[model samples]
Target: MQALLHKIIEQPELHAYWLNTLSMMENVGAKKIKKCEHPIFVNEVILKHASEEARHAFYLKKQIQKIRKDACPTYEWQYLLAPKSSYAYLNQLDIDVCRYLKSKHELKHERLKYAAYLLVTYAIEVRADELYPIYQDVLRAYKSPVSVRNIIAEEQNHLEEMEKQLKAFSSEWEEMCRVVREIESKLHSVWIENLHQELGLS
Candidate 1:
């Protein structure tokens, strides 16, 4: 993993791809923040999550600037929203969940959207939990900047918060949560593959 990170960091295109991907994720969070209109407490949690995501994006941008001192990287909206793009998969999954809830006439239910959000957030946090440790290990092994440490810590906090919120509706939303988890599992596999291919690892 350390070797791979070194290779990627040495390649400008690969590095930019990763930085842009992180930027796209922040854009998704911004979109979610705009769409969130749950009750006060839930809305507060959602906003906080979105704000942290935006902050993570800023951190990633700073990291990119460290590599390309003259210019900061930016992600094209079209590329990020492409059908097979990992960003698209993650963002669209949330949209799909919302639609599914609305179709079941549960959209307006007090806890339904909150439950769906928690499930999706949990899946994302889990993915981060798995990936960030590899990044940290690689950075430590390579003596690279460990700026990602704070993001990893925040991701853990997000995971814990999501899990705590999930407990409230787990019984009633068991089947939906299971279904979302299965879908996320598949999407996440594709996302990981996309990242590998982008990094020329596969």
Candidate 2:
């Protein structure tokens, strides 16, 4: 699975799709953060994270554009013919989760909502930390782009910030983390399946 994921990231066309999809997800995250009602300090931290996410998206989009410009028309067309990218699937999953939470009125309680968001954010940041190194190594191997390294650094910071926020929730931290980990694990499975089907590796 790791090898296949690495292979996907190593391909210019597919990697572009990943980057574009991630950009969309980051934009979604920022929008969600903007809607949350939290303490000033918490909101500020989240806002800073959101801004960094937006910047990451911009960097990724630029990298995608560069990849497209240098890629052959045929290669690009193959990606167009492929199924929805893994990131797209994950993005929709996030949207669905948020919608469900909102519909259930879980988001009506500021503290609960904030805790939920923190858990989700922590899960995502941890996943990013895990995946970014693989992406950085592959990109380095291909001498693809230097921006990814910077993005990885920012991702690490995001992870640290998330950990701090989670720690602040002292009492509920463990339970929330457990729930979020389970949710993320299921999503991760779906992501891998999506990647396999999209790549015709299934």
Candidate 3:
């Protein structure tokens, strides 16, 4: 797992800006899960997520290194620094959903839940996963190096994993949303407290 960072560090094709973006995304993913109302389940999900993200960071770092071996990598701790990057979509999706919900008098509980999942999956996860070969696809059209295409293909497995989890749990999407809202509304402060504690943000 630790070696994954080395792999990311070695990839020359990734830009410094993008590497920093990935670092922020790792934090966002972990923080989003920390906001979950289910503590035991959320904890497990976050732990696994953090590990996977750390590995991804490593991979991305290597990608950055491959591009600029001598360049000193910037390590900013802020998560939302790059607004146009893939992580930006996550923030945008949240705002859009909140805005939509505010306009609705009463969302069907099922729709709300499915919407939330779709918002996260499509807006966040899928968007991030989609960025890969689009970079190469343009290059290929212009006849750029095809080497980066392999990395994009490999990166897709994460999207697959997210889809598998979604498929497994989507049947209960309505119930999950109803329960999530109920749980959230009833214990909103608890979720906030958990986030504060998990992120060590005073």
Candidate 4:
């Protein structure tokens, strides 16, 4: 990822597209939260999480202007780098986590959904915390104008919130996290390999 970051930031168009891709992925996350919202029991944390994620998406999209105006005009597949694996990364993780939760806990309906959300969001937040920092380091080293510091701060808080929620949700929360991370690690590798191939670095 660090190497990819180093190479990607040198090209304005690719960098802009990368930021747009990140924005699209963030928007997808926020969309999932809304889709999973309870009809009558939506909570404050859920609302805050969704809103912050949407803002992160918007913030990233706005950053593209610094690289080049109109670089990636839309969040279409053709405008994104490694579109297939990028989209699959989160989708596949959610499926796998839900399956794991259902089988292990015999969770159904809302219980199943909330458990999966907690695990999936925790895994993704962990990644965001790690990824944004490395990307920020790359940006600074290259003296690039783009910055993800704001996103990084929010992701840190998100991770902490997810951790506390997970503990309150299950006594076996650590075990659940271990399984989800395994699933996420494989998906992330595929995502990164796809990007490397697109960048001709694989």
Candidate 5:
């Protein structure tokens, strides 16, 4: 799976799309945090998440805008902000008790690996957050620097803040990693089976 992710990353446009999708996912994650009533600790996490997510959206939008503006100098930013369906899915997940239960069960079988997977995921998100300048360098390589720097700045802030927040939740890291590995293996097999079934490959 990591190899697959690396393959996806090698294609610049696909890499951009993958980050865009992840930003959308983080946007949903922020929304999930907002609805929590657990404790002060949870509230702090939620607040930080909301802030990070808004920045993620801003960064992704700016990336798209840079391309659109370069291609069409007269393009309105609003035109570039077209609605995306992933937001609906994010809203549906809502980081609630049900989702927590699902994640818990997903890890119950092999806790430590689950923790490791999540940590890796968080690390990837942070790295993605820091890759704005890299994206700018990309645009520059293409001789197009239409992206707003401010958006990237905010994303940097989000990366730092989110990393700090994620660290606070690391107490159960070992347990989660153990579970995550087992769960992911099961999920991988199931997912492959389902795809095969749908494609009549079985």
Candidate 6:
């Protein structure tokens, strides 16, 4: 994994696609949050998080210009690395978490949807915390023009914010975290392996 990260950061094609992948994930996150918005009113925090994720998608896309303009003009599979695993990572987490909530908590309708949001976003935030810093470290090491330092700081705050919300949502929030991490862990492993295969590092 470390070898893959080191190699991925140093190469322009790999770096561009990786950033596009990240941007796609961020776009998915924002869209999912918006889909769950209350019909009448939405929480300000939720709105802010969704907006920030959309910004992250845009920010990452814009950074591709630092490499080569229009290197990834769209999120087409041709321009993305491991698009299958990349899209599945979040989609599967959301599906599995919603299933768990419905089965375990009997949550339905808006409750189930919001709970899924909390857990799914929490899991993704945990992932971002680990991913962005390592990518930033590599970028710094290679003197790369692309930097995720700002994203790193925001992701840290997001993790902290998620913890507070999750605890308030359930006394069993830790167990929920355990389940989410387990699901996301498998998806992430598959995603990384796919990236390795895509990069010919496997």
Task: Name the best candidate (by lDDT).
Answer: 4
Model 6 superposed RMSD (Cα): 1.0
TM-score of each: 0.79, 0.77, 0.48, 0.98, 0.42, 0.97
lDDT of model number 4: 0.91
Instruction: List the pairs of residues colliding in candidate 2.
Output: none
Task: Report the C-alpha lDDT of model 6 over 1-202, residue by residue, as the tens digit.
Answer: 6688787777888889888989999999999999988787688889999999999999999999999777999999988899998888888889998998899889999888888999999999999999888888788888999999999999999899999999999999999899989989998999999988988988
Question: What is the C-alpha lDDT profile of model 1 across 22-75, one tens digit per residue?
Answer: 667766765665455464555567778888988887787777665556444456
Local accuracy of candidate 5 as per-residue lDDT tens digits, 92-190 = 222232344355645433333233324433443444454556655554555554353555676566556545644565665445444433443453355
| Runs of candidate 6 exceeding 4 Å displacement | none
Q: How accurate is candidate 3 locally (lDDT)?
A: 0.46
In model 1, residue pairs whose N, Cα or C atoms come closer than 3 Å (at least 3 residues apart or on different chains), thus clashing, are none
**What would the TM-score be for candidate 1 when compared with the true structure?**
0.79
Relative to the true structure, how large is the alpha-carbon lDDT of every model?
0.67, 0.67, 0.46, 0.91, 0.45, 0.90
lDDT of 2 by residue, 108-188 (tens): 467656765676778788888887788777667677763478878888988888888888876656665766677777877
Whole-model alpha-carbon lDDT for candidate 5: 0.45
lDDT of 4 by residue, 1-202 (tens): 8889888999998898899999999999998888778889988988999999999999999999998987788888988999988888889989999889888889999988888888899999989988999999999999888999999999999999999999999999999999999999899998999999999998
The full ranking of all candidates by lDDT, starting with the best, is: 4, 6, 1, 2, 3, 5
Poorest 10 consecutive residues by lDDT, candidate 4: 69-78
For model 1, the superposed segments whose C-alpha errors exceed 4 Å read 1-7, 39-43, 77-84, 99-112, 173-175
